[model samples]
Target: MIFLFRIGFLEVSWVDIIDIALVSVLLYQVYKLIRGSIAVNIFLGILALYLVYLIVRAAQMELLATILGQFMGVGVLAMIILFQPEIRKFLLVIGRGTEFRENLFKSIAQWRNSYHEDVNVNEIMEAVKTLKATRTGALIVFSRDVELKFYVETGDVLDATVSKRLLLSIFNKNSPLHDGAVIIYKGKIKAARCVLPVSENDHLPPHFGLRHRSAIGMSENTATLVMVVSEETGRVILARNGIYLRGLKLKQIEQKIVEYLQNTEPANWEEISEEEPTTTEN
Candidate 1:
């Protein structure tokens, strides 16, 4: 309460505003990291305990304050131990951001345009047709901006050119690499047999299998398109926008991929069906 040029104690300073802004930013980042996580409960618990400790200390309760003070002294180390997984995940996310990666949207937009200009859509169509023809089960994840390094770490890193034969071999039942999803980035197969997240959709059709669920999960988590084909039925499925498009034929799948890849727009399955037939007679 020192006198600092205030007529009626309406004192404020630039340092106070700066401190508030810094705290706000830190809290916002923490909220982002802990959202949809159980670590938030642990955080609130620590905060509540701190408030109680402060109250006890202020009331001149020697025993309670002494016990609470001891807890407070080791609280930070306890928190780090208890929330080890969450803390590691948060640090990984922050580290990834500072790893000198290029802009995500710009990279995606480049791929979208490059696929149309540089890549051979006919060859891709041929591969898609071949995949459907053999009734080969396949899961191909096309990565855009968001990195799938965690999932990629779980698989064999190929970093090879995307080709029909390579994709077919990976998805062939007899092949060693047929077990998991292939992650493609910038026209290269960055990883093969990569495990992916699974969707918990209750309304999914009974026929939908694990590959579809994993594809939906990957799509939901990142800005990527997951293409899945069922080996038993030769049916094609595309996972994007957190929705699964089941029973898509070659042309429809191609169109949907081009639409999402090039435009980043939500597709209307109904409109697509009305505009083009699902099947093409041989």
Candidate 2:
């Protein structure tokens, strides 16, 4: 390798610069993934332990160094266990980036037209508008390429057609099924009162409640579009691929759903509407 420069005893080269750049990018991505969660604290704790281990070993403290060395030896497995969700999310990101996955998703979109029917977007929009007006909280999950049977099994099977009336009734504050989420697939309500995994993202605004967190978690884990209506503020929030758009108008929400179903990218927030600014709490 050709050396570019020398810093005292250390030689810097093009390969070294490239290696450092790649490692920096990787660390940045990992930090972004776990930034707002409990995983960050755990990550820091592990880093601290490693630092201590290095110090002890350098000082020739044999007893402490040996114990720390053993811990370090098992750190890889321990990290896998402790950060399972983060690891899964990381792998999912990598998988999504592959050309094969993109082609597969495109194929799935085509298959929907021949095999699976789409849900009534108008009915869903109407129900969401009503829920927002009435300050009735609701979580609705729309399945995409992935089959969410595992999550569906967690709730009551509905097998009912999608309708504004049915959605309103299901999410009525007094209704028993109002507490959990409703899963929609193939133009039908496949399940109701489904328990979704709540996100541990600490970066989520403190104002966001359990409903929003659950929506984020479900979206992160699956290729689904999740809608959440805040019970407290009557704000309509839409989540896709773990990205949450808060205070969206009914028209904006409809357009997003339509675009997503049509296998096209949704309009950016700025393009959605300038008159109605999207507000993200926190």
Candidate 3:
């Protein structure tokens, strides 16, 4: 390595600068991935502890340093276990390439729109509108490019057709299936009362309830669209890929759903009504 400068006893070289720059970039990316989540707090706490350990050791505090050194020895493994989900997500992005994943989902959406022809966007919109008016809390998950069987098994399997009346009845406060989430795939309700993972992102609005947190978590883990209706505020929210869109109107919700499911603009209700119904079973 070519020496660039000398700071007292330390020699700084071109390779050292490049190495430091690469490390800084890697740390920044990791910070971005864990920001707004509980993991970031944990990460900072660990970092602070490590700094304390170093200070104590330099001060010749042998007893405290010995204990802290033991913990620091396993720090790499501990971090791996602590940030497993974030690490997996980071690896997934690197392996698949963000553009490739987006294009793949778009192609799938286009194919589903052309062949399935059974989503009944009008019914879904009507159901959501009615739920919004009634201030009924609801969580609807639309699966795409990911298999949600693990989460689906956490609830009651319905395997029923999607209809406004069915959706309304299921979400009715008095209904047994009113709690948890309703999973929809291939334009059918595959499960009800499905317990979805809750997000650990502390930056989510304080007003967001468990339903919204679960929606965000599910979207964060899978390539899925989640819809949330607030019971207290009568607001409609959409979540996808860990991002949330709040205060959506009926038309806006419809447009978002269409774009997510079909990668196209909202379709005419008349044409949707003309299409034949499609059915499937789990």
Candidate 4:
């Protein structure tokens, strides 16, 4: 191997440079995927501990090295458990990217945007408008690509047609099924009062509550759109890709929903981001 440069007594080679560059790129991509979540801090803590372990080993502190070494031995499994959601999302993105061109046409359901005519989205917006006007808290999930059967099973299954009256009644303050989320898939209300995973983002605004956290969490774990209507303020907010879009009018929200169903990535959200800083679970 040829040394390209020297840092004191240490030699640097092109091969080493290439290896470092690739690792850095990988780390950057991982950071991008997990940055807004609490996983970033956990990842940093693990990295710091590993660096300390290396230093302890170099210093010949066998007692400390042995302790950290034991942890390092099972680090891979620990990371897999801790970062299960993030890992799944990363891999999903990679897999989708690789096969996107090949599967673009054959997968009819993936083109769920086509369901626009069938989904009766008008009823949802009307229901949300009423909910907002009444200051009633509501959590609604729209999933076109995936059935979200697991979360759907968490609540009472209605499997009824999409309609404003049904949505309004289900989310009514006194309704038994108003406590959790309502999942709409394939133009039907599959379930009501469904529980969703809560997010672990600690930097959320003080005003955000459990509903907002759940919305963020569900988006983090699945390719779904979550709409949260604030009980306190009657504010309408949307969650997708673990990012929140706040203060959107019904028209904008409808547009975004259509875009999301079409499998389009959010291009610009800076305006709403300025309105609220963005959830928490342990």
Best by lDDT: 2
- The 10-residue segment of model 1 with minimum total lDDT is 273-282
* Alpha carbon lDDT at 179, candidate 3: 97
Per-residue lDDT over 30-77 for candidate 1, one digit per residue giving the tens place of the 0 to 100 score = 554454334666789999999999999999999999999999999889
> Could you tell me how far off, in angstroms, the CA of residue 8 lies in candidate 4 after the best superposition?
45
Which regions of candidate 3 deviate over 4 angstroms? Answer: 1-118, 264-282
Candidate 3 local lDDT, 243-282, one digit each (tens): 7766555776787787767745334311222222221111
User: What TM-score would each prediction reach against the true structure?
Assistant: 0.60, 0.60, 0.57, 0.61
**lDDT for each residue of candidate 4 in 11-113, tens digit (9 for 90 to 100):** 9999999999767656655665665456777889999999999999999999999999999999999999999978986686567765433333323334344
Evaluated against the true structure, the overall lDDT of model 1 is 0.70
TM-score of candidate 3 against the unseen true structure: 0.57
**Candidate structures ordered by lDDT, highest first:** 2, 4, 3, 1
lDDT of 2 by residue, 188-263 (tens): 8999999998876788988888999999887765667888999998987887766788657678888877776655
| Model 4 weakest lDDT span, ten residues long | 273-282
Name model 4 segments beyond 4 Å from true. 1-75, 83-117, 269-282
Question: What do the candidate models score in CA lDDT, each in turn?
Answer: 0.70, 0.80, 0.77, 0.79
lDDT for residue 112 in candidate 4, whole number 0-100: 43
